[model samples]
Target: MDEKIVFKPIGYIKSPFEDVKNMPKSTRESMDVEAEMIINEEYLESMSSMEVGEEYMVLFHFHKSEGFKQRVPFMGNGPIKGLFSTHAPNRPNPIGVSTIRITEINGNVIKFNGVDMLNGTPVLDIKDIL
Candidate 1:
């Protein structure tokens, strides 16, 4: 059977990485790269319960990635591995998740770190890690 699922973005990211090539290679590299998640006005209430200093998983879409291969080099140039084994952006669903700690919340904007996604990435959802 074939089915379709649709999702609406609750927000978008504001990060220094305007291009994928300029993004950090790993989470360790992006830990200090501050970013912001600007929640849409309609979703502003969703942030009411989120607290600064708490960590949450941010699910987003890789808007620029177009396709994927089952097997590919690790980190662009390494031993080949299955797509599910690596963190490549190109995938069957082009969805991404990153864990970030909330540093500040002003209105509907959340300032955080641990960003590894490109600027303007559409945020699908946010969830508490616990």
Candidate 2:
């Protein structure tokens, strides 16, 4: 029997980026953007004991990228490569993962930096990187 799995976002990501075209042309090191993780009420309790000045791995869904391209040109390099081999947003499962530095934490909201996701993206999970 074929089985299917589904997932619901535990939170939402808020950022200054409104469109994917405006995302930084470079990776994490070159971007100094700020963003926030507004977690759902049900997951608030799980954030307890998380300290300030820490980092976490954020997994999120790129709801905007719907079509998949078999090959695309690399961002910096000018050669076309398979979608899976490059970090192009288009994919079967457009999930984005990034490690960000926690700037502050207030209640269910986590303020952070080094954000690369578009505004209102659904966050799948957050893992402490201690």
Tell me the lDDT of model 2 at 119: 90
> In candidate 1, which residue ranges exceed 4 Å CA deviation?
none
Clashing pairs in 1: none
lDDT of 2 at 8: 95
Inter-residue clash pairs, candidate 2: none
lDDT of 2 at 105: 93
Minimum summed lDDT over a 10-residue window in model 2 is located at: 24-33
Q: What is the C-alpha lDDT of each candidate?
A: 0.90, 0.81
Candidate 2 ranges with C-alpha deviation above 4 Å: 25-31
lDDT winner among the candidates? 1
